[model samples]
Target chain A: MVVLLLTILQGGMAYRQQAIHGLAVTGLSDQITWGLYIGNFTFFVGVAAAAVILIIPAYLFHRREMRRVTLLGECLAVAAVVVALLFVTVDLGQPLRIWHALPFLGKLNFPTSILAWDMVVLTFYLLINILLLWYLLYKKFCHHTLQVKHYFPLIIVAIILGLSIHTVTAFMLSGNPSRPFWHTAILAPRFIASAFAAGAALMIITFQILHRFSRFRLSKGLIREVALIMAFSQFISLFLLGSEFYTALYRHTAQHSSAVLLYWGTTGSEGLTTAIYLALSASLIGVVILMVRSWREHVPLLNLASVLIFFAIWMEKGIGLVVPGFTPTPLGEIAHYSPTTIEIQVTVGIWAVGAMIFTILARITIAIEYGHLKAIK
Target chain B: MANSRSTRRGFLKGTVAIATLTTATLASSSQSDEPTAFADSIASFLQDHYQRMSKDEIGELLARSERRAKREHGVDIKCHNTSAITGVTFGYALNLSKCKGTRRCVEACVTENNCSRNSNMENIRVLSLPEGTRDLNQSDHYYGVEQKVPEAGRWYLPVQCHQCDEPACVQACPVEATWKEADGIVVIDYDWCIGCRNCAVACPYWARHFNWSKPNLPAKEINKNTHYLGNRPRMAGVMEKCTFCIQRTRKGHLPACQEACPTGARVFGNLLDPASEIRYILENKNVFRLKEEQGTQPNFWYYTDV
Candidate 1:
C-alpha cells in the first residue's frame, strides 16, 4: 500500500509540470517526435496482452493452482491498461483536447485514425476486465457461493476482446504505409508472442517476491509453468526478429540497411542496437540454460532467467520498436534522437504509475483471494 | 459455424452494394461541391460520410466553412469554389534539354507563391542530378556547407510537388484536413489538422514540408495580399506543400515559377483540356510521372533532354 502511494506520488509529481504547462515540457521535436510514452505504450500493451497466455493455461487448459495466481494476472492487466491510457494521454501534444476524441463531444476519425479505434477498443477491454475481476472477487467475498463454471464462457469472450485491443494496436502501427519498417504483416503475432514472453517472466518474478515475503502462498508448479513460457516466448521473439532480418538482408532491397542499422547500429551509433544485441544474446543463453528441468528447479537461476527475459524484451520493444519505424524516414535521413533527462524522468514517471496501479490492485486481489479484507457479502 | 460464414457473405454483399451505390451517386454529380447544396434537384442522393446532410441541410454549414476559411486564410476569397472545366490554362514547358544550371524557377516559385520572401524560405529546390542518371541517386539534396555548383556532371532537376492525381497524402489525413481541389491542386487545412503527420509519411513524392517553427515573416516581407486558396498564414506543427500557386492559377495568372523559368522546364495546366501547353507537352514530348509503379498518378509530368 505504501509502495503504491509512493509511486503515485512520484508519477503525479513528475507529470505535474507537463499538466501545468503543456507538451513543451517534453523534449520531443518535429523529428524523433514519439518518445518514451509511445515506447512504454507499446511495451505495456504487450505485457497486458501476454496475461492471457497464463490465463488460458489456468482457466481453459485447467492447470491446477492456476486459479490462485490468475487473479494476480487480472491485477497486472488492470495496471497495464491504466498505464497504456496514461502514456497516450501524456504523448498527446494537447492532452486537454483528448476529450475531443469522445464522439459525444468531438468528431471521431474512424478507420483512418488507428488512435480512434485504440480509444474505442481499450475502453471496452478495460470495462470487461474490471467487470470480470469484480465478479470473481465479489463471488469470493460472498463465501464463494456463486458457481464459477457459469462464468467461464464469459471469461473466454472477455479474453478474446482483450487480446483484440493489443493486436489492433499492433495493426495500427503496421497498417500505415508511411512507416515502412512498421508495415510488417507479422507485427500482431510478434507482439503477442513478445507479450507472452514478458508477461510470463513478470508473473514468475512477482510470485517469487510474494512467496519470499511469506504473506501469500502460491503453488511452485505455477511459477515453473510461467518460467517455462518465458523461455519459449524469448525464443519466439528472437526467431521472428531473425525472420525480419533475413527478409531485409537477402532481398538486398532499399529497406535492408535500416533493419540492419536497427539491430546493429548504423555507422557509428550503438543505440537500440546494443540493447537488441545484448538482450538477444543474454536471453538466448538464459533460455538454453533454463530449458533443462534441473536448472529450472533452481529458484535463483529461474529468477535470473526471468529477469533477463523481462529486461531484454523491454529494451527490444521500447527503443527497438520505435526507432526502426523512424529511421530511413520518408525523406530517408536517419533522423537521430537521444532521450533527454526530462524524457527519461517522464518514462520513469509512467513506470511509477504502472507500478502504483499494480501494487494497489495486488493488495485488493490478495485480500479477496485469501480472505484478508473480505468484501461485504 | 455455417451460419457465421453465411452471415459474413451477407455482410460482404451488403458492403459491395453500398459501395456501388456510393460510386454511382458520386459519378452522377461529382462536378462540384455544390452536390450537397442542390441535392433536392438531384435524385438517388445518399448522404456523405463526413456527416449525412442534404443540400437544404447544409446552407448554414457551408457558411461556417467559408467563415472558417476566411479566418484561417485571412481573406474571404471564395472558399470551396469549384473551377469550371473551360480553362485555357497557359502552361510553361521547361526544356530540360536546353537548360543551363540556372536557378530561375527557384526564384520564380519563391516570388509567385509569396513565400518566406526573404529568399531563405523558398520551397522549390534545384536538385542537381548527376550526368547519365534520371533518379535522385546522383542528386545532392544534402549539398550545403559551401559546396560548389554543378558538382562535376550533375544535371539539375528542379524538384517540387508533382501535383498527383491520386495524392496519397490527401487520403492519409484523419480529419480530411488536407485535400486536392478541382484545379489539380493539393492543399492543407492547417487549422483543422492535429499535425499527426500521417500525410507527411503517406506522401510518396516527398514534396510536403512541415512548419517546425511559426514562419518567421518580417512585417515588410509578409505578402499582405493573401488569397485563401493561394497564400495564407501557415500554422506551426501542421504540414504544407506546393499548391502550384492555386490562388494565382484560379485567377488566370501564371505561377511565379512559370514566369521565372528561363529554361521553361516547369509546366502547369489543366490536363483535361487538350489545348493547354501541358497537353501539348503531353502529346509532343515523352513525359513521365515519377515512381510510376506506385500508382500515385501525379499530374506533374517530367520532361528531359528538352
Candidate 2:
C-alpha cells in the first residue's frame, strides 16, 4: 500500500503528460528516432514472456513445486503489458493519431502492415491474459463457482500466442529491406530468449519480495526451482547473444558498422551505446557468480545473484535492442542520438507505473488465494 | 542560343522555303500575352484523360493558367501549349569530357527555381568514380577530384530525377498529388498533399523531400514571376521535387541549370525532337541512367566524354 502512491499517481501522471505532448518531450530524432521507450518495451515483453517459461514448467512439465508460483506469472505479464502499451503509445510521431492505423477496424492497411498486426495480436493477448487471471482468482473467491479446467486450453494457446507476438514485433523493425542493421535472421530467437531470461530474472525478485511480505510461505525447494529455471534460461539467452555477435564480427557485412558503433563509441560520448556494452559484460559476470552451487541455496547470495542477472538482462536485452539500431542510418551515415532528461524521467515513470500495476494486482491475487477476500455464501 | 539555331537553320534552307517561320517570331507565337480567353473560362476541353488532353482542353488549361497567374503572382504567365511532336522529340547528350565540376549549374538552379536557401533547391549529386574502375556500382555518390573526379582514371556524374515513363512514386501516392506531364516531368500539388510520406519510401532515387514544417520563406524573395506549371506557392506539409523548370521549358527556353553550366556538361531537350541537341547527344554520347535495373526510365542520364 505504501509503494502504491509512488507507482500509481506520480508515475501515471508523468506518462499522461508525455502522451499529451507527443514525442516532442522525448529524445527521439531523425538519427536516433527510437530510444529508452522502445528498449523498455522490448524488455517488458521478455518479462511478460517469462510467464510462459513458468507455465511450461508448471503445466506441461508439471513440476509440483511450481504450482503456487503460477499466479505470479500472470501478475508479471499484466505489468509487462501495461509498460509495453505505454512505450508504444509515446513512441508514435502523432500519438493521438495512432487510431488512424485502426480507424473503425480493417478500414485501411490490412494484410501488408506488420504494425497493424502487432496492434491486433497484443490487444488480444492482453484481453485473454486478463480473463485467464480473473477466472482463476474468481474460482478461489466465489466458493468454487468456476474451475481452472474451464480455461486451460485458452491459457495454453495464449502462452503460445504471446511468444509469437514479441517475435513478430522484432520482425517489424527487422523486415524492412532498407534498414540493413536491423535485418538479422537471428533477431527473433534473440528476442525470445532474452524475453525469457529478463522475465525469469524479474520473477525471481518479485517472488522473493512476495514471500517475505505475505503470510503464505513460498517453499524453500520451490524458490530454488525458480532460480534454477532462471539460470538455465540465462545460459541460452547469453549463448544466442554471443552467436549474433560472432556473425557480426566475422562477416564484413557493410551493415556491421552499426554493431561497430555500439562496441566502440563514435565521436566523444558513446552515450547509451557504451553503457550497454559495460552492462552486458557485468550481466555475464553475474551469470558466472550465480552458477556457483551454494549461491541459489542461501537467501543473501541468491538475492544478489538475482539482482545482478535482472540488471544484466535489463541492459543486454532492453537497451541493446534500440540504441544500436538507429546510430547508423539507412544512408550509411553515422547519426548519433541520445535520450533527453524528460525522456529519462518519463521512462522511469512508466516503469514505476508498471510496478504499481503489479503491486495492485499481486495484492488482489494474494488476498483471494489466501481467503482474505472471501464473500459470504 | 535558341533564336540563333532556328534563324541559322532557316537561313541555310532559305527562310521562305518553310511557310511557317513563326519559329523566329516570339512576339507572334508566345502565349504569355493571352488573357481574355481565361476571363470567361469554362472547363470546355471535353474532360479529357491525362494522357490525351485535346488541343481545346490544353487551350482551356492555358486560359485557367492565366487566371491563376493573376490570382497568385499579381502578374501574367502563359503556356505555349505546344504538343510533343512524334519522331521529333528532343534528347540531351553531354560530352562528359567537358565537365570540370565547377558547380556553376548547382548555383544557376538555386537562382532560377527560387528554392529556400536552407532547402538547397539543386538536386545535382556529384560522385567521383575512381580511376580504372569500370564498375559504376562501386562509385561513391560524394566526390572530390582525388577520390575519383576528372583525375588520371576518374570521372564525375551528377544524377537527379529520371522523369520515368513508369514512375512508382506517382502510382504510389494515395492522393493524386503527384503527376507526370506529357513532356516527362514529375510534379507535385503542394496544397493537396497530406504529408503521409508514402511517396518518399516508394521513390528509388530518394528524389522527393517532405516539408516537415512551414517553409522558411522571405516574402520579398518569393519569385513573383511564377507559373502554374512550376515554382508556385508551396504549402507547409507536402512533397516537392524538381519539375525540369516547366515554367522556362513551356516557353521553349532552356532550364536555368543547363544555362548555368560553365563546363557545358549538362544538357536539356525534348526526347521527341530528334533534330534537337538532346537527340544529337543521345545518338553520340555513351549515356547511362542510374539504377537502370529498377526500370524507372528516368529523364536524366549520365555518360563518359569518350
Best candidate, DockQ: 1
lDDT of 2 by residue, A285-357 (tens): 7677567768667777777777777887777666766667654543333556667666776777787778888
Put down candidate 2 lDDT per residue, B5-74, tens digits, no spaces: 4554344235222322332243354555543322222121112222334465456655665565455445
Judge candidate 2 at residue A12 and give its lDDT: 59
TM-score to true structure, per model: 0.78, 0.67
Q: What local lDDT score does residue A234 receive in model 1, on the 0 to 100 scale? A: 75
In candidate 1, which residue ranges exceed 4 Å CA deviation? A1-33, A212-214, B1-139, B145-148, B157-167, B180-184, B207-217, B225-231, B254-262
Residue A209, model 1: lDDT of 75
Put down candidate 1 lDDT per residue, B1-306, tens digits, no spaces.
567545544653465456655655776756644323233212212212223234543443345445443444444533342342354333334556655556776666665554554325556666666689764433565555256554567676665676777777766555565676655677765444555555655665567665544554444444444444456655445566777777667767777777776655567776667777788888989777666655677766667654
Clashes, model 1: 8
lDDT per residue (tens digit) for residues A1-377 in model 1 = 57656755666776776655444456554445565778788888888877787678877888867766777788888889888887877665434435435553234566666666777878877787888888888888777776668788867876897688878878767865656677788888888888888888888888777776646786777777777787787778778977887787777555455676676576544766776788787778777767888898788888788888888778777777776676665444556666665557677777877787777777778877788777564
Q: In candidate 2, residue A21 scores what lDDT?
A: 51
